[model samples]
Target: MPRRLIIDLMRASCDVPFVSLARTLNIRPLLEARGAAASPPGFAAVFVKAFALVARDEPTLRTLYVKWPWPAFYELPRNIAMVATARVEDGEPCVLPQRVGDPDRLTLAEVDAIIRWGKEAPADQVPAFRKMLLTTRLPWPLRRLAWWVGLSFGRQRANWFGNFAVTGVSAYGGGELHALSPGPYILSFDVAKPDGTIGAMIRWDHRVTDAALIARTFARLEEVLNGEIAAEIRASRASEPKPVRAIGA
Candidate 1:
């Protein structure tokens, strides 16, 4: 038998409530080979950007619910994204947080690049990851205090955790319909079929919004992925280089 060293759970320990939801979009006909020589953004970036863009019109998903001191909902201006990224740490595979602010305005290529840099860079060099490391290094009790203060009061929550989070399960080769997150909106992207159909799952804090808003988000997501986003990706083909796969890609 081997003795194991137990570690404190950092972000996972936060007591946030979320309502699980899922939407299946039929993107089959959208990918009918237009002879695109360039590679498109990874599924994760596509979903993240799509959500941010959709949020511009809806605005409901952009609101966060803060409890403690005084219960309230806060609306954020920029669509900051907290993407779950896998990186190498201490010669082992570890998942860290990679934040992309203003993802709504950034092109798909740019968003893809930032996420790639987070995955490729060392944990100490990446600011988001460095902060995560520092917070987790604290004793569990202190860590809880910090999370409580940062997440429940002022603009620290959006600054620290971003407006929303994204995680993917399809890279593991299964079409998952849910992933855990502790914020207003966390999206889980499933596998894409050759026909272009993909599964999208959302976990949202219903205190600020509801299932109706998420349903609209799903519709807008499919719209951008197959419409405007698709056009942008096609345009990138003229100067496209090698593909940059996201973490777990």
Candidate 2:
């Protein structure tokens, strides 16, 4: 059944110790530039790249607590984002995750295109969706085993799930209170306000690091969004049609 997928995910998530931290980010500059762009990238894409850029410099953001053969921390080489995208499956709506690897190295436009594809593409066509369907179809015992193995392993976990996740309910008029994910980091952001403020929250695993690092990461995220992310939007305007000059009248 469609519900089984989320149920399985919840079962796996319940085992992790997740702590959430929230902050209001001022991104008026990025908002203004994005609004003027010919094709504005989705907020998810923008946030994904911004967070990844911060993670690129902060290894703590890239670290994960794995309980496989032994309990230890595993740091990924790059950032992988598991973005939760809503889709209609069997005539019912469901949220499925789409993976975007090394988002820091990707252009905002590139990340947006991939996210748009995940939202618009057929559920069966999206690899993540298909994989989830297959896993859920397995017997209960097998399903539990699959989740355990996936969560226990390090590299396989990153490749299968991701180092972080992005999910939001901003389109529905608010943000998620405590969004859960199997990854070490999961970020949720609300709609941008007229004054350029947006509600952002990160629910991270406690076994990896502490709040001080995440606080600094949030500050750096705001900087990246206003700096390089805004610059990218302005760059997109280069392709805009130049205003015609009137001849002397």
Candidate 3:
């Protein structure tokens, strides 16, 4: 087959139903309710933590589909990763801490430490620093290549990789939302409102996960945010001892 023709064929075969499914399910009310009760940490950390927890709890969210010889196939595993662009020192574009696997266990201080170090590191060393900070397995070259391929194919063929992609728009305030091209995972969270309320909008890839499942997940997240999880976070923070300094010695 001709190269263009092959690409067209693949594109045509790509799943598109996920977009429709995502549109039908709304996540605003659920997230707003949760935000009203408990405070989620800073945007970067909260998203990193939430993605880890959600992916761990919902294995289906971590699945991906790749072409096979006999027949096309889907593979499931705990292989989800979170990517975000961070602003370092004014307007510079620096990628900070692309954490892989479960980040839920990481304390707020730990997350801050990683981000702080990433920002302070020299520009040339940034990539290496991020890789070391995030994953122990994947080499920098492979990770970069994989991300590039994923972005290229994901934009062309929606169902090629994992089930979802979450984007944090908190830095942009409450007005804008991010959308992933041709994938089931589309999510955005607003800045905390004066009343400590915010909207969590998820535009899913309908082909992979159904609207009902997404809605249920959003509802569950709200429950976690409002219930014991919030309390636990508060207690955990409260237990930490405050630093005391002796008077001028």
Candidate 4:
């Protein structure tokens, strides 16, 4: 007899989002130059930094349609970063959203480290890891309740889900256009092409902003990723100690 699949809270919560859109970006130069650049922090870190810069420049998109207490929109001052990752928890694989605070001020390396550590280290050491764990551990009914509450209010929304998200797929080679996301904006990119280019898409909230603003943000994101982020990665890589072979001792 076939086994019955046990439903998990994580899988259930993902279905709560009401709406999402799709966009794409080709970042060949940025990808090609990443390894050649000093201290490249990988695509995820660079992407998070790029999003932070763009969000800083254009804060209007940060506003959220909150429907709690009274209908009101809330604008967050700084971005709290979150990257969606599949984590092994208690012998089962679960998708957990890792948090990165004050991403705007963090360099590519710092952001990269936070994400790397989150992936490699114990869940207890990671910030907000427990919250996700607890949420999933909640009684099935409560899990749905919490998600509905979080997704409904503006202030509560930012507290649960960050201002922006980056779901990095550069390491794995494939092209996917849209990613289902909860934040106001998210970046989903494909693996860099052999020629050193990438395809990125932004799925934004149409409730607060339109396609024009998102298009512009996507443009600025590319500029910052290729310019400032690329430079920093290159500089960092230059400072690393090079491996040396001992002359036939």
Winning candidate number (TM-score): 2
Q: TM-score for every candidate vs. truth?
A: 0.86, 0.94, 0.60, 0.82
**What clash count goes with each model?**
0, 0, 6, 12
Compose the digit string of candidate 1's lDDT tens values, residues 1-249.
Answer: 000111332344246677888878876534542236355677678778888888877667778777657888788877889898876567766677688999989988899988998989867788887776787677778877876777776388888777788888677895775555556788887787775677778888767877887887788788877787777767777665666888983
When summed lDDT is taken over every stretch of 10 residues in candidate 4, the lowest stretch is 1-10
Instruction: Give the top-scoring candidate (lDDT).
Output: 2
Q: How does each model score on lDDT?
A: 0.74, 0.88, 0.48, 0.70
Worst-scoring 10-residue span by lDDT in model 3: 1-10
C-alpha RMSD values across all candidates: 6.8, 2.1, 8.5, 4.2
Residue lDDT tens for model 4, 130-166: 6766666677688778876877787678877778778
lDDT, residue 96, candidate 4 = 63
Model 2 TM-score is 0.94
Residue pairs clashing in model 1 are none
Model 3's number of clashes is: 6
